[model samples]
Target: MRELAGRQDDEGHGRVLERAAEAIEQASGREVIPGGDGELAGELRYALAADVVLGATYTGTLPELHPGERLALVAVCALAAAMPGCVLGDLERELTLLAGELDQAVAAGRAATAAAASRA
Candidate 1:
């Protein structure tokens, strides 16, 4: 039962992250190359922030995320916002790492719940 709940949570979180990534990509325009330095970074940062806010709204519920998770999310958001050039690839990598961390947290939570259940 707990496993099911955890899986649901994980799936839901994955969807949210995907949407956030998509939003960021869409707002900033696809096929970002490389170069443009300062101007590109500024544009990316703004777009990323907008995407995060959009994702937050899409989820309906406020994120009850841990500090570390929140920070990672924000870091990725900021990175996307301040992308150096048309570096969509780099931004995607950062987002992937952030999502992985979130997945680890969800797995840990599920494990904890399972341990408690076993004890009970």
Candidate 2:
């Protein structure tokens, strides 16, 4: 079970990296140079600020990334930071609903596991 969980974690991390690559490719199409001197650093500051304010969840992956991938994720967070308050509020509403659903699912899974263990 631990190995399965580890593989799932690895898959999630791989998906994040793959999405970052796609973002870089899209930026390239728009003629943005992700490796421009000091650009990534500047963008990363915004990302960090967003993470602090919004709990954007990028902190875990940022330190392990290369320059290009970091640039991509930071660029995304910067864009999110730039969004209007109304849009952010709408997103918050949606996230709240999803989080509630996830919580319920987790509770159900735990209850099911407990029952199985008691019967064993």
Candidate 1, run of 10 with poorest lDDT: 1-10
Instruction: Give the residue spans of candidate 2 off by over 4 A.
Output: 1-89
The runs of at least 3 residues in candidate 1 whose Cα sits more than 4 Å from the true structure, single-residue gaps closed, are 1-15, 23-32, 35-47, 50-55, 58-60, 85-120
State how far residue 43 of model 2 sits from its true place (Å).
24
Q: Candidate 1, 59: how far from true, in Å?
A: 5.8
- lDDT string for model 2 (16-71, tens) is 44443343333323223223332333433332343321222543542233223333
Local accuracy by lDDT, each model: 0.46, 0.36
Minimal lDDT window, size 10, model 2: 1-10
lDDT of 2: 0.36
Instruction: Point to the candidate with the largest lDDT.
Output: 1
TM-score of each predicted structure versus truth: 0.37, 0.29
